[model samples]
Target: MSELKTKPTLMEPKTFIDGLSDEKKRNDADALLTIMSDITQQKPTMWGDSLIGFGQYKYQYASGRKGEWFRVGFSPRKQNITLYIMNGFSQYQHLLERLGKHKTGKSCLYINKLSDIDVDVLKQMIALSFQARFDSEI
Candidate 1:
């Protein structure tokens, strides 16, 4: 198995956000940081280079892969905000219904802009996602 990488070492928000070339992406990252921190009740940390993460949990896959990762997190990618919800969409269909325009993958929700979605609903989704992670004991 590959050695698990530690979380990103960069801690300064300004430098981290400035590292993003797009102004809109930087702003989106800030907004997501606020939302995630509020819901997770944990300070934001720059995960890898681009993902702004809050709170963390360790997961051990049945395949014998194990690592530490944020319980809930988001990455302001070039095209959209990639929301990481480890539980996936099967359990959050109702919340997704209220989330406005978005797409889902195995563990990511993709949205082009925060303005295109409901802020309150997004917060609720984050809270619910975090709860689901805990409830599932993952």
Candidate 2:
């Protein structure tokens, strides 16, 4: 059997947040960092340079393509904040209705302006994602 492509690395969890350049983006990053951190009950890690990743898991496809990825993560991108939830939003359309301004793909939720969304709703979304992933695994 093939091994996982990448195992977790010992990156300084806090440094990733320190590297943000834009004050607003940096602050945004910090806010998200705290939310994701709390939801995952895990420290943040730098997945690449721009992504702040939380807990991780391993996956191997039927075809034997294997990889390791964080349970949840986000990137403070130039356009917007991109959240990486392992599951998609279709499962939680009701929550999205009250989540305020955002967009979604299969596994990504995009928020350009934080002020446009209810922070509490955002927290629930995070918690829902965390719980959904946990429960799905059982």
Candidate 3:
């Protein structure tokens, strides 16, 4: 069976964040690090080359494919800050409504400008989602 492509690596999450070429992205990453760390009370780790992750969980698909993945994480991508909200956002619509300019996939929250979002609302969403995933509350 094919393995999961993005697994935890030895690279330091902060170093990766520091190496980002865009100043705004770098600053936004720092803010994200702080928010996620404060909520999870866990140090962030690098997942593959460009994704910073925190905590972890294991899951198996119906077909028996299984892997470990971060409980929550983000990637400062070229297009936007991509947040992996593992518990998904259905239960967080009220928070998303107040979150300012952003977009979402099934599990990814894409933010172009950190200044455009309500950080407190974002923090709440992160905390609730992390708790849901980490504690299996969902």
Q: Which portions of model 1 miss their true places by more than 4 Å?
A: 134-138
* lDDT of candidate 3 over 65-94, digit per residue (tens): 878888899999999999999988888998
* Models sorted by TM-score, best on top: 3, 1, 2
lDDT of 1 at 10: 67
Predict model 3's lDDT versus the native: 0.90
| Predictions in order: lDDT | 0.79, 0.77, 0.90
lDDT of 1 at 1: 85
Q: What is candidate 2's CA lDDT for residue 69?
A: 79
**TM-scores of all predicted structures:** 0.86, 0.84, 0.94
lDDT by residue for model 1 (1-138), tens: 886765755676557877888888888887887778778898777777766677778777777787777778888788888999877788778888988999999989999998889989888878877876453345
Q: What is the C-alpha RMSD of each candidate to the true structure, in Å?
A: 2.1, 2.7, 2.1
For candidate 3, the per-residue lDDT at 86 reads: 94
Model 2 per-residue lDDT tens digits across residues 5-78:
44455666467666767778778888888888877798788776677777766666666666777778888898
Give the Å shift of residue 74 in candidate 1: 0.9
Q: For candidate 2, give the lDDT of residue 89.
A: 76
lDDT score of model 1? 0.79
